[model samples]
Target: MAIATPQQDTPPSELAIEARGLVKRFDATLAVDGVDLTVRRGSITGILGPNGAGKTTTLRMLLGIIDPDEGTRRVLGHENPRDVARLIGYLPEERGLYPAMKAVEAIAFMGALRGLPLAEGRKRGRALLEDHGLGEAADRQIRHLSKGMAQIVQLLGTLVHDPQLVILDEPFSGLDAINQGKLEVLIRGLADRGVTVIFSTHVIAHAERLCESIAIIAGGRVPFAGRVDEARDRIPAQVRLETSAHDGPWRAALPDTARQVGQFWFFPLPETGVEPLLRALIDGEAGIQSLSIERAGLHDAFVAIAGEAAAARLVTSDAGEEG
Candidate 1:
């Protein structure tokens, strides 16, 4: 189906979701603590963290799937998110589909739960399937489809109701590279149509590529939240230098933080700038074979903000559904 593009009547700066000091606990364990997040209307925002970082818990609290032990949230102007649940679409990390149901029926059923009439839902579902290259699979049973195809069906269901705000938890978890790329495109398309998209993922690359703003969570606490550029700015740019002389007085010009890896020297650009270092290298007769200043990327920023230990868990399997 050609998703209807909502009129862009809302200001870009208008808040779609505002969550303050959200806290959730299970037994004696704190899953989410003191998370404050904001999403601008018509923007793609990401909740980024490693496995077991409470990303899912925070999202659930925001959606009113589970009440926060403390704090408050406003979703699409409703102080209680449940009051506006019909306008929000959520795809949980744990995906499910009825084995006996046809792909189209599954999508329609999901839409019906969100208030779309079954007949209308089925019509939209078929159109969506055809639009997404799943037309041939529309009549196939969920049990017969490949894992990737089934996941696509669930994703299509998430949008069948054309929700104004969409929340996805680790939407990329099990997909291969090809499907992951396709999903990314779909997400961008939603934002283009003026839908507010908020997704949680441990993958920094996805956030770096798709999210205008991000919240970095770790150990049940949010360490950073804002525009991607602002998060990257938390760390200084890095300098990668390769000199003809591997060792010389020129090395003295390099900061104490500099480390030699292979033939390259890596360090944060000194506060005084690279001019002084370049001059010292030239005067000291250290042949400057190559020099490059690299801006800190999302991965670097994540490591800096969440600590190396937390960053190490990014690519690991999620600890539980709440991760």
Candidate 2:
């Protein structure tokens, strides 16, 4: 299927999705707090948050699956989402495919519902399957395919219509590293063709690797939104050092906040260069085994801005899932 691209004279609003002060309530609980988000055209943006941080709720409101209690949203420049629903493709977190249907049939069926002709959908579906290394499974029933294969088929179904904007909710929730890598490549291909991609993922590394911009949602609100580098800048750089001398004048020169992890010392990089510290160690005859300066990653920034508690919870959940 051909991807859609912006026209030379396309309107000045080069945005795929925009929402301001969005809020949602479910009975007695507030599911989504006031949140503002912007997704640029022809770029991949990530919505990152913990399990119940309202990522799905925010997407639902933007997709017209549900209305926000307070705030406004525009998708593809349409104030009303339904007006542009057909121009967007969405893959929900939940897997929903008929077990009895052949893989190609299921993909084409979904496309047909979105106004894609069955014949054309089938042709594209076969091509998509072949391109994704699933050509042999095209005739197999959903029940007989591996979980990863089924997932790929569903994603192909989402793309069968060649939507201008694609929304994926927790697209990597359950997949091995190889399949996850494949999905990332697929997402990049879509953006390269001028298609906008907005995906929600709790895995910080995924956003750090794939997103040009991201919205960091926590506790049902977005606390940060901007370039990926901006998020990483929220925290200072870090340093790790190892030495033969455990205690000496060199040790005294180290910051009081320095922490020891096994045989290594870890701490935030000092405002000054390592020259002074190195000189101190040399003067005191402290043998430097190793040293490394590291920049803050998305996880570090998330912890600094969203608080250790939330970061800990997210990390724990991620570990459990991966295990």
Candidate 3:
């Protein structure tokens, strides 16, 4: 195991996951070339990437499921994960509960593996199921629950020990919308208790709303990582506006900051620009029935900083030729 930090003298309120230049290789191919990430002690950190972008590989290394070929990682400030896993919980991409086992028993077993007492683990397991709205499902066999219910069971299993840091990889795959919302609330609640939370998901919009910080992995590397709002500002916020009128003078009458959206003219104004823009729009009768300000986001920033063509190069790269 490689440790980025030798010791944890700092307050435990610091970062939960600190990785620098993490790399993993299988055979001649580099599954994860280089990536740096951090999960703050009480915040939800999101890792965004498409299906073959090495998100899972990076996560596996971070969780100590597999050692990286090169680079350093620390979870809950412990380099030796067997010791740290006592406080660091991981929910793998695949649901690992045994379908033949009762929900309560499966959760208890998972917790006991982390060194929790069996009776305490079972008690906590039942309570967690109730907290997650599945109190009645505790005695039911895993295979008898609905897909969504099973997911909740697995999640409760992940939390039975009340670990301080939780890492979830694609934990929202089969849930319906309502279940997704519940999960979001649960994640936020965990963070509220000062549990550093990190998860990978392709559901960009939902993650965008919940995660204040995000890391974008593209082609085995991190192309973007920062505050979501600041990341958005990096993308060019220019849009060409379109209008139904074939030839409208509103383009010229608009403020100097205006750019084009489609046929309509778009303009970025000062903090005071709102009133003047509306005034100008109404005055010129731009026939502007619709007006929207386009802002950059994780989506636009991903496409801009790392262009689609750049991702294509990585996709066609020999690294994942077999995937």
lDDT of 3 by residue, 144-183 (tens): 9998888888888888898988989987777776787788
Estimated TM-score for each candidate: 0.90, 0.89, 0.82
Local distance difference test, each candidate: 0.87, 0.85, 0.75
**Full-model lDDT, candidate 2:** 0.85
Tell how far residue 216 is off in model 3, in angstroms: 0.3
Off by over 4 Å in 1: 1-13, 247-249, 316-323
Ranking by TM-score: 1, 2, 3
Alpha-carbon lDDT of model 1: 0.87
Query: What's the C-alpha lDDT at position 61 in model 2?
Result: 97
Residue range 1-323, candidate 2, lDDT tens digits: 11112222334398887788898999999988888877789999998888898999999999999999899888999999988877889999998999999999999998997889999999999999999999999999999988888988999999999999999999887777778889999999999999999999888878888999888888888888888888897877788899999787788767899999999998887777778777877898779899898999888888887888778756423333341
TM-score attained by model 2: 0.89
Kindly give the number of clashing pairs for every candidate: 2, 0, 18
